[model samples]
Target: MATQTLHRGRLIDHLQLVVNDLESSRRFYAAVFDVLGVPIGGSGEDYFWADELFVSSAASRAAQGALTGRHHLAFQARDRAMVDAFHRAALAHGGRDNGAPGERAYHPGYYAAFVLDPDGNNIEAVHHGDADRSAASVEISF
Candidate 1:
């Protein structure tokens, strides 16, 4: 098989999830990201954020007084084991099991797990078996 080099980064500027209960959503996402090894980027009075996703309360100005409808966000995982850990952490912290970790027919070696976050959003962690990347991540300087 030919080694394919890919660059993964900066597709979406950001994603915001406005929830009815901010703290519950916070705990749920915090646990989920921790297992995936993405740290909380920062937080404010009504929200907390990771790399590209922001979880906030409906009361926050950015929420515009409405809760976001259900959204599905798939995160990248380093390996199959990380996908398993994400499912467990999500379930332990206010998430419901949507699907267990396993290889999916989405494509060869597409192993993943799904969980419903506090706002009923379908969250997924997927690991596309062994592959090569041009960079672990990319940085765009302002």
Candidate 2:
């Protein structure tokens, strides 16, 4: 697979979801992320990650306590076409449709699609129209 990286904003460093079945979650996310042009970061026997989102089984030390409730996570899509592709790919790989692809009332040119992952997390792919940017993301050097 080709390597792809997403530009990160300052607010979120990372997010994790504790899932009942790691394999199922892996398949679901892998297919969706592929459409968004992001590559899987890595994986282990109990965990798999893409970009800043980590999915792991309860057996992993980071998820040994309890599984979390549903959460909403939205990923930025490069364009409306990518958002549509993401929705289709997600459904083909164990995701259920929460909302179909279309313009949302959130704001002008807010095209998005929502899907429920294997663990019932509300995942979304959104395109905020077109805009100019100084840079894709800010790079912090350690």
Candidate 3:
């Protein structure tokens, strides 16, 4: 198993999605994360991960004999163009569009795009417009 790390935040330390097809999920996530500027942290025969997101095959020991149900996960995008690119890349790589890139009533400047992964999970990439942040993320090493 690979070491897992977390970026301290308000809630939810990390998320793992057990999928029926690891390669497909990997491809889909790779393309989408590429647009979001997040790198693939590491991978093993039964799994691959990106930052806080862990994707593994149902056969993996950690999967506990089941696959995850559809869930919604959103990634923060750098800007609207990155959100658009995320949509296009996802569509071209085994993802089905759930929502096109655009602003939403969720809040002001909530530009985002939504897509369903191969397992039907609602994946999103959003940009909350220009704003200040303490840090992009908190990294810890072991």
lDDT of 1 by residue, 91-125 (tens): 99999999999999999999999999888999999
Per-residue alpha-carbon lDDT of candidate 2 for residues 1-142, written as tens digits (9 for 90 to 100): 6655554664567889999888889888888988898899889998888778888888898987679879999998999999999999999999999999999999999999999999999999999999987777765433
Off by over 4 Å in 2: 1-10, 140-142
* Better candidate by TM-score, 1 or 3: 3
Error of 2 at 70 (Å): 0.6
The C-alpha RMSD in Å for every predicted model, in order, reads 7.0, 3.4, 2.3
lDDT of 3 by residue, 8-116 (tens): 6634567899998889999999998887888898899999988778899988888887997898999888889999999999999999999999999999999999999
**Model 2 lDDT, residue 114, Cα:** 98
- Which residue pairs collide in model 1, if any? none
Worst 10 residues of 2 by lDDT: 2-11
Q: Flag clash pairs in model 2.
A: none
C-alpha lDDT of residue 95 in model 2:
96
